[model samples]
Target chain A: MDKENRHHLWLTVPALLSIGLLFSAYGLFGWTSFYRATPGGLGVGGDFTFDNYLRIFGSWRELAVIGETLWISFALTMISLVIAVPMALVIARSPSRLVRSILLFTLAVTFLSGGVTRAYAWMVLLGNKGLINLALVHLGVIERPIRLVFNWLGVSISLVHFLLPFTVFTLVGAVKNLPLSVEEAARNLGATRMTTFFRVTLPLLSSGLVVAASLTYSLALSSFLFPLLLGGGRVRMVANHIYERLFVAYDIPFAAATSAVFLVLSFVVILGFAGLERLVRKVVVR
Target chain B: MNRRSLERPYGRLVPLTATLACLFLLLPVVFVVAFSFNDGAYFQWPPRGPTLRWYVNFFESERFMTATEHSLKVALIVTPACLVVGLPTAVAIARGRFAGRDLIATLLLSPLIVPGVVTGVALLALFTAVHGDLGLGRLLIGMFVFGLPFAVRTMVADLLGLDPRLEEAARNLGATRLRTFFLVTLPQLKSSMLAGAVFVFVEAIDNFSISVFLTDERSAVLPVVAYQYIRDFDDPTVAAMATLLIALSCALVFAIERLIGFERMMHINRK
Candidate 1:
């Protein structure tokens, strides 16, 4: 063999090993979803069956959980877009490095502070006598502490926070790609700034918006902690359901089945958005 | 009249909204830091007094310390493992003109797309099915699996972003492909590699959904232990530990920004 060929062969080993191990790991995970769980509730024992798949999909409870998960994910994505698009616009349009860095720093802290810590922080903020409640009471906004925890409201708040930085990062790329001159020309043509933003800039930003929403949606859909901790066991995200099936219910086959379905569903949703993004690019970005 | 109406609303509104949004985004971390030093035992609003009691308790407690050590050990080991296994894949993708490249890239990065909870449950099932006990080895491998995508993504970005002419120039001067890669390409990847390593390390420490299933009583990482502690005790010790982690992460982010520039770090997160 030639020297270059040998080097290519050798260099390819680690990459190949990584690909093999990853595929096998996921493959095994996918493979085991087919078998029936052991009666002992320890592991899979019986022959392959579609019963596990049937159970997860057939039950209304499981179906609602899936629906709720998708709803929360969509809500999280939209909220993140509302909050992040403006900030990302500011970041992209600002000529000052200081402003960009400060914004970026806030995003980094939010993005990197880990979900558990973020959840705890939200707990402090949203607890019955938590800061927000206390402040609201002091301000006479409410007569009593509201039930923020153990509900959809709490889940949405935390997930929005968790997903914000990602949305911002995605949007920043999109906004940066937009030419400043386009907005200027629009304004010079007698369009109002807001109109220019809504008509020209936003249409141009459709691709980035889709990318950000898709990312945030997927993250929220698969979210475990916000629902587990902040949702206070009352909220039922698919992730929490999957966790219960595996650890609480000791139903391995059901858990695996749920996971396989979850994987497929997430791919479908993400790819759907990617397709939407392509469509938007074709129609609007031109 | 037109300029005043046009400029005043947004000029005032944009920064105000942005500031408020940033504050809302940052409030949670600020609260974690503030409450960690609270004199009271439980996590409650309005501190009794500023005190380091929780920090002392966190450091002095053997269980918490051990969990912290476990977290550090896992991150330390997993970062290097990711680099070794992921770099070649990144190099191959960047340099090779092979078919199915995009497919291969997607497969390598699949872990990032899959939910952590699902990955955790799936891996736990696989481990138990193949081997009875979920050991530290299995946990390490699992984490390495999770970290591989980030490492490869970062390295691939770094490699692709660089001018190819430098490596090509070295090769034309008679340096072997291996030597050129090691001397020319590897050195250039140092900053991004450091950033990637830090990212993976933090990920290993921060990972809970996957680790929770894989971790036994004797092998819990800090986040899992903190979670259990929160479940059992309402003390500020977990808050204290969290504050410490936040500090460490901030420091790492600062270092990464210094090493590779902050914009580049943010760009690496795109994948």
Candidate 2:
């Protein structure tokens, strides 16, 4: 036991170093957010103030961004929940191994592919001159190209696809635990297929949906690449807002202040979801 | 495999939903790959004609190649470093009874919870102040923070599933703890290590949100370069580069599927 304990501490050195590095950086970020941004200056030592925080709250533009971030995250999670159920049922309940593996393979590829590649692919697929529009025009679905890219609709579409793999994987286990007998029983009782799914499967899936929602919400909240590549400065989430503020305007303090707020906001929202998920599980179980 | 799956059949709707989901997943990847081969100098819906010129151009360009090199250098360095730091922590989490193990695990895994850009913003601020303008070294530290959690999570899951009796058996035979780990335990961890290595390597190379803020021209990774390319030019060179990544990621999915079973591999991230 003593030897084992020694090995344990020895093993944590690298983790300790990692934490030490990150926290010190985080400490610096928080510390820097307080300093007054000297005009015509790179970082300079000066008296600390709440000016950075005040400035973010002071501006309607920044508050709008924060609101947009929350709205988008919520919408993304709701959309994911709608889609994760059917996909999870397929993955967890498919009779053919080939079909299951193929679906899983598609998901793995989506999950494993680089963010930049995925983002670029969306750009090509959704851009004004891109495939979807071109195909639509050729088929006489529309004369002029629809506004698909550079908006919430395009961002939501890409991000929902981006998020499906994780959300499905989260809910798959729950689907597996559900007995086929229950659905079969409902079908035998003269319930239609759609009725069986809605009345039988979905309520049972409530807890799983909530759990997956928490995961989806968190992933959506951190979404950066899709919004950055596809949003075209129209729908700036908090991360991009911070990026633009820092790089475009060279406002380091404000960026830090925004990040600090984002961090707190994410924690509160995720914690709320966690609490909700637990309550859901308890209610579902009872 | 679930034996029930052998007996149970999904109706038409499930399969239909799943197919559409696959198409939605595959279309972006397909478009990117297809456009890379387009002979047009501009963005054309259909290829003007098929050609290998863009792929050739990507390799010949010093700018893209150097960014690829920097990406490779960062991933190669960060993967092993993640292993060194994360392996011990994973072992502790998997087997140790030490105080503060939970806290350390949470600290390492915090990157999953916190927005990755927070790390980028924080590290950029801190590193800029301390080093002013250093390049890869600063980026390395940033990558380490993000990479450690994944590295730790993979090993922890693998280690938990490992039978603890093997190490005890080695110890009973008078092998030292280090000897047991190197000779018996480490060998068993080979699969997890391989999976983790591939996962971390790809993650480091592809990661942008954190790395973006930390990189200067000298330290920019492939994604940053690709991002810049698309922003500046309407050319298809970035598509070629993206195709290469798509192919590599496809190969990785298949590789993990063959070696570790793709679902098990994904479970690491799910955890």
Candidate 3:
């Protein structure tokens, strides 16, 4: 028994040690601000105070920035879902092997290239003297180039391009899980195609949609590279805000506070969505 | 006859629409490939001329070579470390029947769920709190943290699918528990381990967000180097580097596919 206990202890100890090490590392980094606030800045001598939190709330500029960040995140999520859902449905239900293979390859390429490559692609496409502008001029649509990059529109387009593949993949999984027989049965009952889809298929696909939305929203909210490069510092997301705070301002406490807020907000959004999904499921079952 | 003909057209429409969607997705990638060989330095839609100068330039550059080496080094370190920590935890979770199993699983998988940027920010915060600068140690720690959830989840699913009776039979044959684990159980887990390794390798190599937060110039990985060049200069050198990366990723994918049929290898989510 003693030997067995020792063996189990040996097994558990390493895991515990690793976990402790990770947590300790995290705690140490997080508490740096608490130990030493910047000179002429809020000191960390007292117990954990709400000074940083209050300052964020008290300042209108900060509050507006937060609001703008949330707004962009929300918009990106909604727009990506709108584009992704139909694409996912087409891919899932389509019968052509060539089409399926091509779609999969596209998804794989897009995901593999990701933020850096895609942003570069967009730059080439949207630059004043770049492809789209050149094409427009050749066709006599516009005499001069229009400003596309370094703005909200550019940021949104780049973000959607980056996120669309993942959304489609997730929704495709959901759509695939759905038993085709149920939809077919509804159609066989003399219901219209739209009716069958809306009444039967949509309900079943909601869970997947929720999951996709949560993932998409979180991704959009925390996106840094795409917005930073494409937005040209004009459009700031929460992540960009945090990066600027840490690197530029050297304000660790405020950055920590901002990160904390962002974390809590994301956690709340996820939990709320999960709760709503559960409630909806319960209601439907009952 | 009328209904059959009607359905035929509808089926054709589905294929057509799907083909269009695929075209939309592949267009940007196709553009990248075509431009990589363009002789012109500028990013023109139709190539002014075709040449292999950029690719040649990429091969000759010592900076690109160093960046590639650094990326490989980081991935090599991260992949094994992830396996070491991740596999045992997966085994424990699989074998043990415990309360809060779901919660533990979720916690293990949470890093994947969190956005990369948030993970980066969180890690940055954590590092700063510890008075540690972002360097090799920090980068490894970041990779391990980001890579763990994926490794654990994949390995756990693999373990669950495997029959425990094989290990039990080995033990009954007078083998010690450790010996059975090494001789019998470990060998059978090759495919899962391979899948886990490939997943971790791809992730470590491709990871930008956390690495961006953690790396300084001395420790900078390939993706960051590529990012800097693109942002700073918009040089065609960036295009060459991206082409190389795409080729490398495709090569890795093909290699894995050769080992295990592409379709099976492609599906990383065992659950």
Tell me, by TM-score, which candidate is best. Answer: 1
Docking class of 3: acceptable
- Tens-place lDDT digits, model 1, residues A1-286: 2343335445556666756865676778777778877766556767877888898879988888888788778877888898887898778776678988889888887777787899887877898878888889989999999988778898888888888887898788778778766776777788876788799888988988998898888888888977888877788899899888877878877887888888898999988999999999999856
**Cα lDDT for residue A75, model 1?**
74
lDDT for B210 in candidate 1 is: 87
Descending-lDDT candidate ranking: 2, 1, 3
lDDT of 2 at A248: 82
Q: Give a tens-digit lDDT track for model 1, residues B20-136.
A: 899998898998899998899765655688999999999998888888888888988999989987788788777666566677777777778889988787677667767747467
Candidate 3 residue lDDT tens string, B193-227: 77778778877887777888888788887778877
Every candidate's fraction of true contacts kept comes to 0.48, 0.68, 0.24
Docking class of 1: medium
By DockQ, is 2 or 3 better? Answer: 2
Cα lDDT tens digits for candidate 2, B4-121:
5335555577778778888988888787888889998667744688999999999998889999999989988999999888888888888888777788777877778888788888
- Please provide, for model 3 over A1-286, each residue's C-alpha lDDT reduced to its tens digit, 9 standing for 90 to 100: 2344234333433444555555554454455434435555323344566777788879887777778877888888888777776677766665665555556656766776645666777877788887778889999999998878898888887788888876876688677677887776776777766676678877877777778887787778778888888888788887888778777776767776777677677788878878877876666445
Q: Each candidate's TM vs. the true structure?
A: 0.94, 0.92, 0.86
Q: Is candidate 2 or candidate 3 better by TM-score?
A: 2
- Colliding residue pairs in candidate 1: none
Q: Where does the lowest 10-residue lDDT sum fall in candidate 3 chain A?
A: A4-13
Tens digit per residue, CA lDDT, model 2, A82-184: 7777888887777677888988888877777788888888887888888889899999999999999999988998999888888998888788778878888
Estimate the TM-score for candidate 3. Answer: 0.86
